[model samples]
Target: MCGRLALYSDFPSLACSLKLPLIKGELTPRYNVAPGTWISAVRRHDGSGQLSLDTLWWSYRPPWADDKAPQPINATVEKVATSPYFRGAFAHHRCLVPADGWYEWLAVGGRKQPHYLTRRDGEPLWFAGIWTERPDGKPGCAILTEPARGVAKAIHPRMPLILDQQSLEPWLDPELTDRETIRHLVHHLPHHELTHWPVSTRVNKPEEDDPALIEPLEPSAP
Candidate 1:
């Protein structure tokens, strides 16, 4: 599960890189983002085929009658097509959550050591997500997840569903509804394509949002 992440790219740079239309307001860098907060997301509307980069609440709440617990920050792709809570969004509200890197905690000597994972070549990563509007009219999203691979497996059991430029068109295009196509896209990203390094525990605190949180820390795994 991707419980924490960091987005350091300036909005203008990100917009240009992702070919997203310019957003009206400026976006500040977030180095210690946690669940249930506003996050930057790229959404494509089906009818107009237009892309919009906007901020949305990080957790999604379903339309079920019961006032159950807040929806999960991430959803499993296997159950998405059939789950009542996520089927609608899976079909219509697909989105992309962009970030420079994400934080994962590794169990070392019974202590949690934070690690920063990013593309090996240092490119920004786009995580597949589903979004929806609540009764109060606020937008929210849930990241998708799959089993971890390669180096990430040593740290955690699951990783975010990351998509590359080649997959972005298919993932974002509303016309493709077949579950098989979407399923094929959820598998592990190339192991060689990513790199991870230990980072300061400063990231453990949600309020510690800054550039330094991503800086490499020594062999402080314990």
Candidate 2:
């Protein structure tokens, strides 16, 4: 469900990779980003029609929901267009969540083995997301997820809806509100597009943020 992510790419490199304008500020590298933390997102300005990079809280809370209401971290792709909690944002507030990679856990022989998944080509990955205004005037977003396929299926039944460069424009185009068209863009990448390997269990802790957490675990150590 994309509960954790890592973004270590520098702003300039990310800007070049995503082909979006960079905002003025220090873009800190985060190796263990968790739900509720601010995340890097790319969205089209409603008036300018230009893409801009911004930071948004990683959980989504509908406008009508109370401050105490549960904020969803992931929105199921199949229900995004029909679910009352996410439909409005799905139709009008689509965004791109840039990440170096994401973490998933697999239950293996009574133990949970954490795996780090990233693009095989080493390019930044962009996950599809929807955003909405918070009561306090800030923006919050939730990543869209679909039933897992290929290598991801070995870890869990769901994974973030990672989008390719070609799908970015249509997915974030605010004018294109047709549910079917949006749904059609929700697809899995080729099985070989992503690669995963067991990583240090240190990533299990949100506070433990460092590059070493993503390094592959020694096969004989466990």
Candidate 3:
């Protein structure tokens, strides 16, 4: 469900991938990013029609909703386009979330084993996302998710809706709201490009944010 992720790539590479203009500020590498926090995303501005990189609270509640509304971290693909709570943002406020990879858990010996899933080529992944202005007036987002595919299927039943590099601009284009057209233009990255490995369960703790969390857990000799 993309509940947890990591973004440790340097800004230069991120800028190159998003074709983003210069943005001033330091971006500290975060290896264990959880929901209910500010995270980086790229989207087109409402007035300027320009692409921008900025931080968004990683949870969503439509501006019209009350403080009691649900703040969801992930929106299922099957319903996001039609759900009243998400359609507006899906159509007009789509965004791209640059991430190094995401964490998913698998059941093993009655315990949950965390696994890291990333592109085989080491390039960053751009997650399909949508945002809305919260009741408090802060910008918030929810990563889109679809049924798991390829090797990722072995780890979890679902995974983030990662976009193909070529589809990034189209996904962010506010004008492309037609469901069929969007389905035609936006395609998920090839599932085969993804690889997964067992990683330290230390990631379960939100406070644990370091490179070691992604280091592959060595397999025991059979």
Number of the top TM-score candidate: 3
> TM-score for every candidate vs. truth?
0.90, 0.93, 0.95
For model 2, the superposed segments whose C-alpha errors exceed 4 Å read 20-25, 185-188, 220-222
The better candidate by TM-score, 2 or 3, is 3
User: Over the stretch 92-163, how does candidate 1's per-residue lDDT look in tens digits?
Assistant: 788889898999998878789899998887777889999988645678899998888888888899999887
Worst 10 residues of 2 by lDDT: 18-27
Candidates sorted on TM-score, descending: 3, 2, 1
**For candidate 2, lDDT tens digit of each residue in 73-156?**
999988999999889998889998889999999998899989999988989898999999977677999999988878888988
In candidate 3, what residue range of length 10 has the lowest lDDT sum? Answer: 18-27
lDDT of 3 by residue, 92-198 (tens): 99998899999999999998999999999999999999999999989999999999999999999999999987898899888999888999999999999999889
CA RMSD, predictions in order = 2.2, 1.7, 1.9
Output the better candidate (1/2) by lDDT.
2
